[model samples]
Target: MAKPKAKLETLQDKEILTSELAAIVGKTPQWIRQLTRDKVLNQVSRGKYNLGEAVQAYCEHVSGGKEEEQKPRLIDFKTRYEKTKAEKAELELERIKGNLHAAADVEWLLSDMILTIKTRLLGVPSRVSTECENESADVVESVVRREIETALSAMAKYTPDQIGGDVSHGGPEDS
Candidate 1:
């Protein structure tokens, strides 16, 4: 006598272990577990899944079915914000560069003006000696020294107004 075997149901909708489902979906077993935890994919048992349903659910999630519209808006806003930030940084850098060049130019001009003033002051002793030439050499030397000392003292006390660069006085026509 032969024992008869009962036929199993068809395997199209069969349950599969998580590792098997992951292999079918080309994903890690841990990813299958995460989907089950997030309720994106349903589990058939502690470590099993309905392979067909899991694949469908994962497809829907990856497609961003209900959130597609908002995603583009978020990406666009981030791009615009980064572009504006870069433009503002560039403008600020240009302004700082301009300020540095202007400061350098002002410093150069002031240095040149100071050198010119020093050259004029050095000529004073020769001019004074010539003017007092009728006197004895000792007296002329003493007078020149006294005159130069007086001029140097006056220069030390001089404000920009005395030398012609005062802004507040407006112009020579104002005097």
Candidate 2:
């Protein structure tokens, strides 16, 4: 006479230790414990798991089962936030180094420069009119040329120290 073996029932009928489950899942026992703590895996008893349920839960977790964020995802979010913060700090440093200027300051400077040029040019006709009137054609031409040259000379020189700008901060480059 031979002894008969009892047939296994459901997959949950088999229970395994954490270390054994960790080996089957190809992860460290510590990582298995972490998954247990996160409710991604269940325990059949202390240090043990139902094989079938553990496998099913692990599959759903890996498949991104619409659960809350995991540790890895939280790490990724932190990395992106730090990267953005660092970029903003770099921009602020560049601005402090005077490598950048505000739009309002630039606009005001341009308007002032244009007004100065306009004033100098408009004054030329008035200043030279009397001298030009009583002179010969060549004399009148030279007087007008000298007045225009004076205005152009002023236009060629620019310094940030004038009015609202600070020389130490430097000025905007030519557009």
Please provide, for model 1 over 1-175, each residue's C-alpha lDDT reduced to its tens digit, 9 standing for 90 to 100.
Answer: 9888887755646789999988888899998888888888888778877767777887877665335644554445667899999998887786666532334444444554555557667777787768777778888878767766765665465443233324343323243
> All models: lDDT?
0.67, 0.77
Q: Please give each candidate's TM-score.
A: 0.34, 0.47
Model 1 CA lDDT for position 38: 86
Give candidates' CA RMSD values in order.
15.8, 8.1
Q: Give the range where candidate 2 is weakest over 10 consecutive residues by summed lDDT.
A: 166-175
